[model samples]
Target chain A: MTKYVIRRLLQMIPVLIGATFLIFAMVFALPGDPTANKCGERPCPAEYVKKFEEEHNLNDPLPIQYAKYMGKLAKGDFGTSFREIPVKDELSERYVVTAKLATIAILFETVLGIFAGVLAGIRKGKFIDNLVLLSTLFVISIPIFVIGYVAQFLLGVKWRIFPVTVNANATGLDSWWQLLLPGLVLGSVSVAYVARLTRTNLVENLRADYVRTAKAKGLTTSRTIGLHALRNSLIPVVTFIGADFGALLGGAIVTEQIFNIQGVGGYIFSGIHNRDGVVVVGAVTVLILVYLLVNLLVDILYGVLDPRISHD
Target chain B: MSTISTRRGNRAEAAAAPSKYQPQDGLLLEVDDLFVEFHTDDGVAKAINGVSFDLRQGETLAILGESGSGKSVTAQAIMGILDMPPAKIPAGQVRYCGHDLLTMPEDERRKTRGPEISMIFQDALSSLNPVFPVGWQIAEMFRKHRGLNKSESLDRAVRLMERVQIPAAKERVKAYPHQFSGGMRQRIMIAMAIALDPAVLIADEPTTALDVTVQAQIMSLLEELQQEREMGLILITHDLGVVADVADKIAVMYAGRIVERADVYDIYARPGHPYTRGLLDSIPRLDQKGQTLSAIGGLPPNLTKIPAGCAFNPRCRMADHVCRTDLPPLREVEPGRESACHFAEEVLRG
Candidate 1:
């Protein structure tokens, strides 16, 4: 298992290089100059442009520039944004908030999603089943921004239940409290997907031959559904949940924007608008690393869920 | 149908005052006029129609039929594991130890499943949960029903694995179902079925999924277990060769009804029903090599639209107007033999 994990980690090196290169190329290819509008409402002077170009290695070919950037990245230097603020400091600050939001979203989706799914699966075609089906469908069809705004208006403004926007400087429990609404909004669609996936898998497993054998073994309906059927059903559901967690960690763009929470999505958003290649490439690189690690964890978990799958 | 009503009346009285029922005259199970139907999109398919049989201690009764002949349905009904909405028992009485299982409280009926009556299905691989270790699956019986602790249950599971003749029981207890070969997996299934020493063990085409040589081993193992516990064994299979040596008596089903029933030796020597005779003729004989094998004509009737009168009339050589107009009830053709045919005596004479 250790060898397998090491191999997986090594495999990520090529993927990380490819992904970062693509983002860097795209950001550089933007139809504008990075040095424009520097030193206020006008183009920089000829000497200033030359000195800036030389210092940042912008005068070199694209490949040579990328190589220089990578050399600094290897030493943990994320470089500075166009505004002269360190990209590394910006990312470090935002990542904690994003991670906490992702954690809360995952927990909310997993607990409620699985619970609703199991109930709907066992009582298929019943009232609760129909309710879950209709509600999930309703949630899935609507876009996230709409739900986020609507929730904010009703629960925060109208009902006086929560803060309309997250307090950016809040820490610990207070931060979590302020982020709760946005977190749930981010997780809403995933909850629908998880619930539906879990329902479909659970219903199928409930009809499996082994479940019949369990019934013949005198297991109560609860034990038969809970232990025998549910265990097998969760295999695919867990895979979905794991992948969704990685995506969530990348951050919800529209959600962070509406709630005004400082997160990776906002950083990437402003970087794209300003055509700041360093900020865009740096933030996305971290997202890529996080996604790869989570995928590896999911694969390892697959082995544990199903005895048939072996890591070796 | 009249006999079924009388039995239902008796069961009604029995259900009024339920109690801990005891076996009478060694009778372990009695399936009386059981009917199972599935309400599908196409129509209600009559799976089992007026099927009835009984088992006594140490007795082996083999139910023989082709696919969809309600043999497996009967077993599932007896086990109380049939999916209810699609599959419904419109009328039936499954009596275990004089207690009517069909009418008994669900909790009470469930309690009887593993300890009093257990079943082993056709495909052992699919029937066993894929993710669980073989021993843990076996140990579940002891843990849940007997309230044994984890270690005690696991110890019992190892012993059961050994009892089923699985080599290296201790080492293989942690092995998953997919790790074992087909025959060994079937043995594990058998081990689980016999774990609590059930009074009646139903083997639903148990050896049908195994090899020829392995089939014999499983059959003999089942026989030995039956004799040791004097358990009533119901072996449901379509294979005549598998049933010949192990079954004391045989029930041949056609279109969800028993077409013929007699001692295993007698039925093989002279089949009273045309369907039984056709089944016997289809079996390949070494003495008759190079000859074209004879098979029953056409196909088993679709459950939704079984032929009028005798269900076998469509394929029977002796079928006439009388065969098509009247459904023949299973009647005694000899002192100890019963056949459901208008001309049972003529078939028996031939």
Candidate 2:
């Protein structure tokens, strides 16, 4: 089992590197220039362009630029922005903003996702199951931007329950209440999917001959459900949680932009729109890293669910 | 002696009570006219139709039937484990030791189920939770029913493992169900069943899913346990060979009802019902020489479209027009047996 876990972890490195390299390649290919934008609409002198090119190493080929970026990344110096603010400073500042919201969003999503799943599975074939299924479908069908805008208008604009603009000072669980609706709206679709998957897997687990045997063993209804049914039903649910964590973090861009919360999504938003290559690539890399970590954790839990697979 | 509580112990007094609680001498259980029905979208399908049987101390009663013929349903009903709504006991009685099992409150019935009447299942691998240690699961039964503390229950669980002949009982007690082989898992199931020393043990197809060698091992273990406990055992299966080896009395079921019932010797020597005869002839026997085995002629009749009178009539070779139209009531044809056939004696003539 230890060997298997170590092997799996080792295998993920190349895959992640390949994926991040592709993202870097894609960003490199985008037709724009950060220096040109910084230099403004006035056509700068050839010498000024030459000076900027030499400093940023734009004089090198694409592969050279990539190699340079990788080297700097290895040394933990992400270079500087077009205006000369160190990229590390910008990323750390932006990282805190995202950390503030993503933490709450993930917490909300995980709890809600698991709850919805357990409820739907338990009340299977009933109105509650059908309602949860339909509601989740509705949540998933709506675009995240639409969910964000609508929630902003309804809860922030109309209800005045939360501020229209996300407060920078209010942090932790204190501000979480304000972020809750946006987080819920953005994270809810995944919740629905989790619930649906959980329900299906849960129903399957419930019907497994083991559950029947547990029931016949004179174990009380609740004890049988908690001990025998829940743990066995969790493999698929755990996989989804792990795989979707990155999505919830990286993909909540529209939501953060709308809410005006200066989080990771917002950082990526400005970076992509402004063509700030450092922040864009860094955030994407971090997102991918988080996703990889979650997947690793999920793989570890598979062993806990059924020891036979671990023994294998 | 006559001045004593003769009224309390008399068979006549018991017979006057509810059909379920009518206990005879040393009888551990009695089920009479039990009709279990399942209400699907279409209509009610009788799972166990008017089934009646008795279980005496230390004797194993085998109810033989193919899948869906209600052998397991009868056992579940006796165990009070059958879920209601889709399934229900429409009529009849399940009496355990002069108590009406069907009418007993659920909590009271629950007490009897774990502490006095236990069951073993067909699929040993599936019947156990893969996440937990096998012995811990058994210990749970001890904890719940007997109120044993941690160490005591642990010791009892180890003892149960030893009793079931699981080697390295103390160490193996912590090993999960998946660690054990199929036969060993079934042995674990048997250990759990006997943990509470239940007077009546219902083993549903206990050996069907196991290999022949393991099947024999489980059967011998059960026989030994039966002798030790003097418990009433209800062995549910379709295997004539298994019933021959373990059961004292055999209830041959076709569709839902018992078509034939007799002692083991009588059932094997002279099967009264045509269905029973067809089944006996199918088994490859040591006594019969140089003959290709006989096969039962037809499919198990679809329960939804069961022939009106006798459910087995469609598959019964000796069935006549009367057998197709008139339901044959169970009739005593000999001193110790009963068969549901119009011409049971004549049919046995061949």
Per-residue lDDT of B170-238 in model 2, one digit per residue for the tens?
Answer: 999989998899999999999998887767899999999999998999999999988776678999998
The CAPRI category of model 1 is high
Residue B281 in model 1: lDDT: 98
**Candidate 1 structure quality by residue, lDDT tens digits, A44-85:** 899998988887788788888888998998899999998999
**DockQ top scorer:** 1
* Model 2 DockQ vs. reference: 0.56
- Separate DockQ for every predicted complex: 0.82, 0.56
Model 2 deviation from the true structure expressed as Cα RMSD, one decimal place: 5.0
Candidate 1 regions exceeding 4 Å error are A29-31, B1-22
lDDT of 1 by residue, B112-217 (tens): 9988899999999999999999999999998888888899889888988998899999999999999999999999999999887777899999998899999999
Q: How many residue pairs clash in each candidate?
A: 0, 1
**Which candidate ranks first by lDDT, i.e. highest?**
1
